[model samples]
Target: MKIALLQMTSGIDPDVNAATLETAIADAAGQGAAMLFTPEMSGLLDSNGARAATQVTDEVHDRVLARVRAAAAREGVWVHLGSLAVEGDEGDPRWANRAFVIDADGEIAARYDKVHLFDVDLPTGESWRESSRYVPGQDTALVNTPVGKLGLSICYDMRFPALFQALSGAGATILSVPAAFTVPTGQAHWHTLLRARAIENACWLVAAAQTGTHEDGRSTYGHSLVVDPWGKVVLDMETTAGLAVCEIDPAAVDDVRSRVPVIAHRRAIPVPA
Candidate 1:
């Protein structure tokens, strides 16, 4: 299947962001893309409370999600609407950071809320406390796509290898990681972490990313990539709002698993301090 990873620079306006998303999806569909993926915070990007203010609504009612659903139906393509800012329970209206799988009929197949909140201080004086603005999900989500079992995870979750191991153990053949990684952290650990996750899990890694700069002047590293089961980057996009397409044969998953067998070679012993 040909999958397209869309790298975009999202702003604070929902209408404008939706238009950009529509155009990008159309372009990818025009190129014969079977499934298209977008980045995190696909609708709006805000620094702090500004994001919290307007995130209070179901994504099914969100205008951007509506347009995305329409695009998927019109183009007869599957859309992985990466992560949208959603309102949660009574704690300052947290962001869900949700991902949706829209089928060809434009029906939502499954949704996954990001489990890990990005709460860290970067070395470049840029600090983010995602838990302060968003709620973390308690369940690990996996969706059966036309391709295979796709594991869903957002930006900060890439740092935790155990999540990928759990997904791989659950028969996930493809892993989707949508991120809005800060430029500093992305420059230091983005590519390496992604490759490491793919190598460790022996699954195809498809990551759509946020690129360039947002309205808040926060720069994101934009190297959207698709790593094969063998940990080779099949397609990569850098510093631009564009699409990276590649054909992923599901057979590669079995080949890699058989060669490595790391998942089954576990001794399950306690770690020595």
Candidate 2:
């Protein structure tokens, strides 16, 4: 299957972002892409928790999601709406950072809430407390798609190898890690972490990324990537708003795992006294 990774620099406006995503989707479909993947916060990027929360609505009422779902059905393609900011609960100050998988019929097949929140104080003088505004997901998501068996995860989730292991154990052959990584962390650990995750699990890692600066006064590292089961970066997107389209064969997953058999050689660690 041919998948397209959309790299975007979205502002704090869901409408505009939806339009951008629509165009990308059409273009991708025009180029014969079977599946299209987007980055985190694809709807909006906001620094103000209040404004961000207000802009997000319930998933059923989110216009961007509705539009993209319609796009998937119209284009006869599958879509991974990487992650969207949506209203969480009644009276709760926080919202949900959620990902959705849309089938060719424009129906939501699976949804994954991001489990690992990005709460860090970076040396670059850029600090974030994502847990403050967003609620963490309690469960991991593994779903089936036309491309392969998918394991869902967001940006910060990539740092936790255990999550990937759990997904792999649950029969996930393709891992989706869409991120809006900060410039500093992206520069330091982005590629390495992604490569490590793919090598460790021997799974195809497809990551769509956010690039450049947003209207929220923040910059992001924008190297969207697709790593094969053997940890080969077949496609690397530039630091701009564009599509990185590549073909992925699921048979490679079987071949790699057959050779390495790492997942089968697992042993639990012993507790120390």
Candidate 3:
């Protein structure tokens, strides 16, 4: 299957972001891609809590998501809409960093709320408290798509190996890790971590990323990548805000797994007394 990844520099305005996504979706489909993957916060990327709160809304009311879904249906392609900041359920004041899988028919196939919250004090005098405004998800999400069974995860979730283990164990052949990562950490750990995950699970890993400085005054390490099951870097859109396409061979998963057989060799670790 052919898939397209959109590396973007999203701003504070949801409308502008939506238009960008619509255009990218059409372009991806025109290039004969079966699906398009977008970076994190595709709808809006704002660091200011006060300013972002004014634009954030529930999934049903998010114009960006609606536009993307419509575009998916119109283009006859699937879309992995990386993640969006959305209002949580009634009585829950906190919001959710959510990812959505929209089918070609414009219907939601699955949703995954980001489980790992980025609450850190970076050495660069930058700090984030994701838990302050969002509630972390408790469950993993896997859905069937044109490529294969995809495991859903956001930026911070990539650090947790147990999550990937669970997904791969549950028959996930492809993993989607959409992120907006800080320059400091991205430079240090991004490639190594993603490649390791794909190698460990013997699965295809697709990561769409945010690039360049945004209206929110934050810069991301953007090297949107696609790693095949054999740990080969098939595609890399290095630090550019645009769209790129790559072909994925589902048979690679089975071929790699058969060669390594790590999943079958995995043994449960007992808790120390």
The prediction achieving the highest TM-score against the true structure is 3
Q: What does candidate 3's lDDT look like per residue over 1-273, in tens digits?
A: 799999999999999999999999999999999999999899999989999999999988999999999999999999999999999878999999999999999999999999999999999999999999999999899999999999999999999999999999999999999999999999999999999999999999999999999998999999999999888999999998999999999999999999999899999999999
Ranking by lDDT: 3, 2, 1
**Which stretches of model 2 miss by more than 4 angstroms?**
none
lDDT of 1 by residue, 1-273 (tens): 788888999988888888988887888788888888899888887785765476447765788899999989988889999988877655555667788899988899988889989888877888899888788988888888877899999999999998999999998999999999988888899989999999998899999999997887888998998998899998889888877777889899999989998788756778999
| Per-structure clash totals for the candidates | 0, 0, 0
Q: Estimate candidate 3's RMSD in Å.
A: 0.7
Model 3 ranges off by over 4 Å: none
* Residues forming the 10-long window of minimal summed lDDT in candidate 1: 48-57
Distance (Å) between predicted and true CA of 81, model 1?
0.8
Between prediction 1 and prediction 2, which has the larger TM-score?
2
- lDDT by residue (1-273, candidate 2, tens digit) is 798989999898899999999888888899999899999989898897767767889998999999999988988889999999888878886888999999999999999999999999989787899898899999999889988999999999999999999999889999999999999999899999999999999999999999998898889899999999999999889697888789999899999999999899877989898
Q: 17, model 3: CA deviation in Å?
A: 0.3
CA lDDT, candidate 1, residue 16: 84
Q: How does model 3 score by TM-score?
A: 0.99
Measured against the true structure, the TM-scores of the candidates, in listed sequence, are 0.95, 0.98, 0.99
Give the higher-lDDT candidate: 1 or 2: 2
Which should have the higher TM-score, number 1 or number 3?
A: 3
Clashing residue pairs in candidate 3 are none
